[model samples]
Target: MTTSHVPAGAHPNDGHAGPRVGLFVTCLVDLFRPTVGFATVALLERAGCRVEVPRHQTCCGQPAYNSGDRKEAAAIARQVIAAFDGYDHVVVPSGSCAGMLRVHYPSLFEDDPDWGPRAQDLAGRTHELTSFLVDVTGVQAVNDQRHDATVTYHDACSGLRELRVKAQPRQLLASVAGLTLLELPDTETCCGFGGTFCVKYPEISDRMVTEKAEMVASTGADTLLAGDLGCLMNLSGKLHRLGKAVSARHVAEVLAGMTDVPPIGAADGGDRR
Candidate 1:
């Protein structure tokens, strides 16, 4: 619900030499973890981008789209497209939302001669954060950020398959000073938080997340990380219920050195940026 340019006063870099980025802060991050939004700005700033958060931005409408509500989804997509019309690039912290904006939005309006071109234009400019940093900005490393914990990573389905975000996060995490990256078995598998999928099929969703949580625990890593908050929150809850000690966080938090807050779903974690 915030149109603020940056979360918690995270400003762009001094020179503002890079592309002007309009951050598409997803609903999950805005509501559940504003720190992820803060970390996103910090990471983008560190990568030399001039970042802005447009106040008029709203949901990417994945839920409605996934539910086969094309009319409502297109209405939402047009709002997002209009809100972020002028940025050099649109960056999102969550791959799910980014995929919606980048991949699905065009198809949602493919038949509409008026909105189709706009959706396609917006789609071309949209990118997930890690991919934007590594692939677009040529940022190969994260400097001055160190997390001394052994961690495993999960590749959310949309980002991994739709956007091909496999090695982008790994490439950046490699630069963290004291961080050890443990590769999760089946890292590319879906975490079952498929927007509304989990809600519609709770039994199947629970089974998938339970297995995914077990895989995370098997790594024996102290922390779990991914680019999408929805997956992290789902797996975090499952891990907590299963009594696992692995903490879950967004990759941006570690990359931006913003892990002072407790892990997602930790009882002590409050809504503070």
Candidate 2:
């Protein structure tokens, strides 16, 4: 497999008077889907945000938090908080990582008087990319881009349930020209890539993703889109194995009108811009 490809985003603070924002590029996105991160920056820039990629940033500590390792997670959380606390807002392309900052970080430092308030502050500003676009900036639509494909949008578990991110992405997708939006059956159903859950319970995860692949194929959509990279990878992986001719992409990539990168799970470097 090829390494993730990073796109060159416009420099933040490029003499623009937008809100100072930090882009929290998640681990999976950094290693496997860098286009999502770049697309996020593009969307933010278009939304009037001066986006910065904090060099000190690391994982959101979700792996440790979910594994019941609060000590390590908290330590990592402190580092993350320090890295992003200076920004006016912190945005993430992946909902799970956003949830880590928006929901879990506060809980991680609840008992500490020092880091507790800091965590709460960061949590309050952190938002999923689509949610930030719609709810915060009040931007109803993105710059209309031409993508003539019927696509199904998967509501990743965390973004849908945790961040309440159902309408924001759909609302933006509506603005894109020549894009037909098809609803995935049971769109809210988990893709069974619950971070480490798939690793621990491969059989059950496979079963769930198999059903998801079938539903995605059933939609007759040519493309599969989701806000979370992990879910995209899981569902895309299953669909690939089943020989489904669907292109999987992050919603940010489409919303940002980026056509230069391959789809998330393309086997032969397909979906080139």
Which candidate has the top score in lDDT?
Answer: 1
Candidate 1: C-alpha RMSD to true structure equals 4.8
TM-score of each: 0.93, 0.93
Report the Cα lDDT for residue 263, model 1. 86
lDDT of each: 0.87, 0.86
Per-residue alpha-carbon lDDT of model 2 for 19-49, expressed as tens digits? Answer: 9999999999898888888889888876767
Clashing pairs in 1: 3-55
Consecutive 10-residue window with the lowest summed lDDT within model 1: 1-10
Q: TM-score of the candidate numbered 2? A: 0.93
Cα misplacement distance, residue 262 of candidate 1 (Å): 0.8
Which pairs of residues collide in model 2?
A: none
Off by over 4 Å in 2: 1-14, 267-273
